[model samples]
Target: MAPHTHIKSVHTLSPIDPWWKRNLVTYHPTPKKSRHIKVPWWSRKCAAALQAKRHAFAAWRKNPTPPLRQRFHYLEAQCKRVILDEKRLAWASFCASLSFSISVSQAWSFFRKMVHPQPPLTFQ
Candidate 1:
């Protein structure tokens, strides 16, 4: 013979609480702006030169010839020189725009920006 079982009554939940009031739901604030950004300083010409240098490097790797190797080295040096020259020119222009009455903090900030240009920033 099968055993008999008794049914138990269950209590219903009172009501559903708001999502914001739930314990598992967390509130995250939206990001309006970034605290810091990294800006690229590579100009179109500089970028093209660098790409050409990379291509030269790959070609030299396949052929391993004296001419190809020399060309690669030449392009590498030229690209580096161009990048540095652009940075120097930019810094010179920035310094030229500054007046003689600016605070030291401002000068330092400007110098930092010149060293590392950040995006979302407008240079004066």
Candidate 2:
């Protein structure tokens, strides 16, 4: 019958379904991480070569013909060569960018990164 008693009854906390639990249950979402990690030396050319090699390998796997097998091997080799070239070019450019113009600290940072690359981020 009292006003304070009425307010307390209206705002009473229940144990069956807490407000925080309701919110957490309603907020199911996808992971906010990237699917593909970018490699320093990865390029469109390398992607194209790898795609071609995958296709060749699939084709060879379906029908085990000698020609298809050879084609797959050739594409695999081409992909490796392209990837190596890209890595070499990337390293050369990075080294070229570091010169007498850069400060000692920057040069040392560059050298450290080149010597010990950071580990890629992983999502479980």
Candidate 3:
């Protein structure tokens, strides 16, 4: 056989390439229902403590030093304590408000909300 004179082109595009380039992918937004349920025990103080604990954790993670780790632990304990205290107080107040006059449906509604709160959906 004679010497082959074959050549290959690297920059060749297929016929369907133009169709893919011309049509853009689009996404439609999904509608969601908003839930405005309120927690009886959550407060601004708890939020602040939790934020501080998160910051301390970030600092500890960045440096991994003993001091920072200790600080993070302390903040974590403090945050837990504050949350527990707030919950206890809320529970106490709720117990104090209990009476024979309260309707069964209203009490059950409160219990339902407290026991199984529906979290908002995130578009992750």
Candidate 4:
């Protein structure tokens, strides 16, 4: 038979929170998103080819091989072509959107902006 000892219980009084404070809206700040515009990948095939070229590059970096270099070069050319096509398409779309009804001043301004896009000024 084991001897049992009586345990003493202590009471704790924590400050009661007000009902209003309990329901108060708390703002949780999240990471700010980048303001830069995200352009779409040239094309699905182009994107895939680019990824493959990257893999080949990593392999070449690890061990310099003539075959890997050749493949990477070929894929690089394909990627460049795709990128050029995408750019042309986007420009075409933008130009098409400015219907005939657009004012001459507005069209001129749009054309000017397209020709020389003022880079966003950044203060370091």
Q: What TM-score would each prediction reach against the true structure?
A: 0.52, 0.59, 0.60, 0.51
Return the lDDT, model 4, position 119.
23
Ranked candidates (TM-score, high to low): 3, 2, 1, 4
lDDT of 3 by residue, 1-124 (tens): 3422441321243454554323322232335656656667777887788888989999999899999999999999998898778778877887899999999998887666555443212211
Candidate 2 lDDT by residue in tens digits, 1-124: 2222222332253565365345544673435767444456667787788888989999999999999999999999998898779778878997878777889896665555444442223211
CA lDDT of each candidate? 0.65, 0.68, 0.69, 0.57
Provide the clashing-pair count of each candidate structure: 0, 0, 0, 0
Give the best candidate by lDDT. 3
Model 4, 1-124: lDDT tens per residue? Answer: 2322341211221235333233332432345876633343235655666677678789888888899888778877886676567657757876778788889997766555444422212211
Candidate 2 pairs with clashing backbones = none
lDDT of 1 by residue, 1-124 (tens): 2322331211222234333234222453334765654333446766677788889999999999999999999999997897778778767776787888888897787667656643233321
Better of 2 and 3 by TM-score: 3
Query: TM-score: which candidate is best?
Result: 3
What lDDT would candidate 3 get against the real structure?
0.69
Better of 1 and 4 by lDDT: 1
Give the RMSD in angstroms, all C-alphas superposed, for model 1.
13.7
